[model samples]
Target: MEFSLPDDNNNLSLTRFESMLKTNNVLFFDSNEFENIIYHYLENGKISLAKKAIKLGLEQHPTSTNLRLFKTEILIIENKLEDADKLLENLHDLEPMNEEIYIQKANVLSKRDDHESAVQTLLIALDLAEVDEGIADLYALIGMEYLFLDQFENAQHYFKKCLEIDNEDYSALYNVIYCYDFLNDNQEAIVFLNDYLNGNPYCEVAWHQLGCQYVIVEDFDKALVAFDFAIISDDTFVGAYLEKGKVLEKKKRYNEAIDNYKITLALDDPTSFALLRIGKCHEKLGNDDLAVQNYYKTVHEDPLLDKGWIAITKFYNKKKNFQKALFYINKAINIDGDNVVYWKLYAQINHRLNFIEEAERGYKKALDLGNYELSTWLARADILIALGEYEASILNLIQTAEFYPETAEIEFRLAGLHFTLHESSKGHYHLKNALLLNTDYQYILEELFPNILKKPSVQQQILNAGKTEN
Candidate 1:
């Protein structure tokens, strides 16, 4: 809803228009003046005012093409596309060469999910366009239609053409880079950005994009240089400072990273992302107090950001303060209960605190949230076994085997649980599979089923598997 205020000329016209409205005076205005007034209302998101202006303008100048076009635009905005399209068709018959008419037609086609037709209509508009700016706009519109088709290559080509026509079109530049990223061609992006920077050396956006490309290619040295050039081009560029800090962090220069992150804090309001990165840098430097303070600030700035809470929880967990870790992780879960990582952390913290039932529930929630990691499955199954829910443990292991059939860990755990339940045939069957997968993982028997390992038949089977492997 944010928009620019009316300039002095427009302000005079707006004041006159409003005064006329209040006094119920049918004041006269030129078609151009009415257009400016309607545009001002539209720009400020006063759609009803704009519609009223259009009605009044057309009443005074019923043959005004621009006013009628504005009416068509409003109809389109209201999703009365059929009315808009009919109006556009009539307008096209009146002025066949009007680029705006073709553009509006393209808009209607796009809204109807007919993107191919939209692209063709935009091409027609491009042909009618006389000015460089209008041609660039049509190119951008065609690029957008290609994006809706998921044709990144075609989108990239058209967006590149738009950027070539207007080097200052940052959105087109972004779309070109996005297509490159989707295609995983960082090298091409790097080369293209470099060539662009040759002519536009002071363009901060291009430099930032080049830096990002270097980061993707793992060329930290070049990335740092590119970001530094971006900062030189625009000292107020917060993104450059952030990317520079990340590269420094990768190089283990934590002090430099903290300094760069702090610069971002000074340039703008304390962003949660900046605060979080600062905390991580502090933690790396062993400034535990400062790290915890910034972490608190991060969550205070943006309570919905789970990373801040997770950072504090992990910081406490690393210090073996399970109570504090559990406290913070609970806050994180309350903020985003569906996050798989949060639930996994909750399970771990609860398990560490011997809150067995809560740990089991947390693990189950994690699984329900689609955390299919082998470790998550094993931890949940182990908790079930400890709680004497042998059947549940077996069921969990069986499901885990589906996701990771080749893992010796799942087979061995299944063997151990079956043997504990006195299901000797099933236990032996799984044990044989586990040995065939990896005889080196026999230590699982020592840890989880020491009694089963002591059986003469199991020992003889292991010896025979080892000999067969030799």
Candidate 2:
């Protein structure tokens, strides 16, 4: 039971209600007007005010089913499922043919995580609902319940049914495509969307979904065609323009990608993603000044956009301006302190600047934040080795070896560490395994342990290992 105040007098009623509240006058609203006031408070999340309104409404019209249903909705929202269920059961007995009672019951069941029962209850509501009264919303609710249960096929079926009932149900249409994608049935989605487009060729959303499917299958050419049609159908569709730009970027059509990204800016307010993408395309095309300008605009438009900050950081790093890189990366870390990628970049920048201790701390923070990249581990170990912490470096490398079990590079690094620690037997054993795994990594021995490479015993061990391999 959605309450809607008459549009013509709605403002007057609201003004009168506010005036009554200010003056502490008795709120003498009719039942429908009270319902509207209560729903306005509820929709605004002012639960206390909504409760007051409900109390007043029930006092004035104790038999109002709509006020009772609103109370049940509040109970469900507050997670008082047992109370909501009892109220809804009574409402069902009182108004046996009321569609909203079933809908409210379904909502309570959904909050209780009994989504299958929720769907069944909503089906009852569907039967009770008139053809023109919330049928599309009922279908959408059933589809959402099925989605909650991970029954993608059933969800897709109900969402498609919703689309059939209301052609303007774009959310349901998108959900149907989402369910198909979740089931890895892109072919079926593409076929169904194509048929839909035959009847509704100007639907930008359908063309966008088709283009996305083509991209999933790595058919960039077909994706381009679909996106072009999407743009032609609706030139002001910012999403279509942005997606077309992405496909062009993937195909290395930098100038074309830039043009599409520019179009998105022209059609709507500049998005962080669009600004960053434009910067990347310009950078690819050697328009360095333009790239920097757009990258600056990206972070300016949305200060919390971590990708924009990261792009600027990488741009400066590529130019060997470590100071500027560090500045931008720190800004990113400030916004998203737990981001492992930002910590990794921070560590790399500090390492380049010879701030060994700071770099080590940054690496540790990155590892703590779940950075399992092979390079991150290797870099951390290298930093420890540079700081003359042979024992710590060996422990770090050993931990890394657990993640990358059969890597010759790790074995070679371990060999160097052991030899540096004067553990000759452990060094010899690791050297043997290293050469056996990959003899080419023998070159790393000199780079990591220059003194040990000149030792005749080490040279003989390497030669012997090579001979054994032959």
Candidate 3:
């Protein structure tokens, strides 16, 4: 959407402009020449040069609206919105039909967080746009404004309008798909991408997106075909290869997934993702040595990739090598201490090694980092009970019950903890609730509170519940 001069003319003008600046001589250039020089400076990010060019340009051609518009743009960039607005108002009076002026005005309004006013101004620019590219740009701008407002439907409509004007506008195509994704309309996205591909069959981006939509909808076969077509359209497309590898892995074609993943390595620099996936495929296929090699390479290529380290740790853990698992998980945690998955895995490995206090601390850190899953809560509470921290276990289970109310497991655990704490009244209350919810899980009571289960009153209550169920 930007215009640039030919290389020769651009170079000649730049040389002349520099010569004039160096000699402190007034050089006269027509409005078009000055505009090109200023554009060149702006495009190359020489803001001071651009400012000087604009100053000299207006001195020579004071009535040139284009040069003044450039000045207004710089004002907007410099956060002089008031001055930019004043300049735009004057420009609009001089040339009410100038679409660029309205566009610049919309830029200022968008910076001020006035998206509605920006969209209105862009609509005016759209109406004034006489060329296809300009109209498409206006549509994209309007779509972005609607996105800022979280109006996905409206954003989709405008971006689709942009595609109608230029079917090859990949930016607009991506935005249209993003809106559909935000609205959770994968089927519509698939249908739209299919229609788009029917016209532009060679668009790798659309084919790649279609594959992802199929993945979301769990149509693995269609996803595979889409990714294949994407690769055919652009054989060196790394994303297509990666998606195809994922689909193959889901289908349990581990060897085939490795083959496809290795293709990505040959086509470009080795990626940690591809290496990790290949390692997993090898592990699934019982290629332990190859799996270990790739896993080590994965971390070597990018030590910051926590998944690679976790993968290594899990592999060791699966083999009952607790020491090695603990070592790798420690490395992963060191790299990304805030990852809940790493903390949870750290807790599990420590627990396996009978390092109860460390395990408890790991679980507590996991919980603090927002690992609120039922398994994590139960593991932490169980660890606390093992450490004989009955009060802490009771409080942990109490909080877990808040997230998972009316659950027999939590209720049973709470009854066991209260009984262990000698809060017999509270224990009986929770025991009754657990039995009411699910008498089938009373085994939890037997497992955690066998002594309580032996009590005559508790046994009779459970017997009464069984008789009531019958």
Worst 10 residues of 1 by lDDT: 1-10
Cα RMSD of all models vs. native, in order, equals 3.0, 2.5, 3.1
**Local accuracy of candidate 3 as per-residue lDDT tens digits, 13-97:** 8899999999968877888888999898888899999999999999989998999999998998899999999999999998999
How accurate locally is residue 240 in candidate 3, as Cα lDDT from 0 to 100?
96
Q: What does candidate 1's lDDT look like per residue over 212-247, in tens digits?
A: 999999999999999999999999999999999999
Every model's TM-score = 0.91, 0.91, 0.88
322: Cα error in model 3, Å: 1.6
The total number of steric clashes, by the backbone 3 Å criterion, in model 3 comes to 0
Candidate 3 minimal-lDDT segment of 10 residues? 1-10
What lDDT would candidate 2 get against the real structure? Answer: 0.89
- lDDT comparison, 2 vs 3, better candidate: 3
**lDDT winner:** 3
Candidates ranked by TM-score, best first? 2, 1, 3
The models' CA-based lDDT, in order, is 0.91, 0.89, 0.93
Off by over 4 Å in 3: 14-34, 41-63, 78-80, 183-191, 217-219, 468-470
Model 1 scores what on Cα lDDT?
0.91
**Candidate 1's TM-score:** 0.91
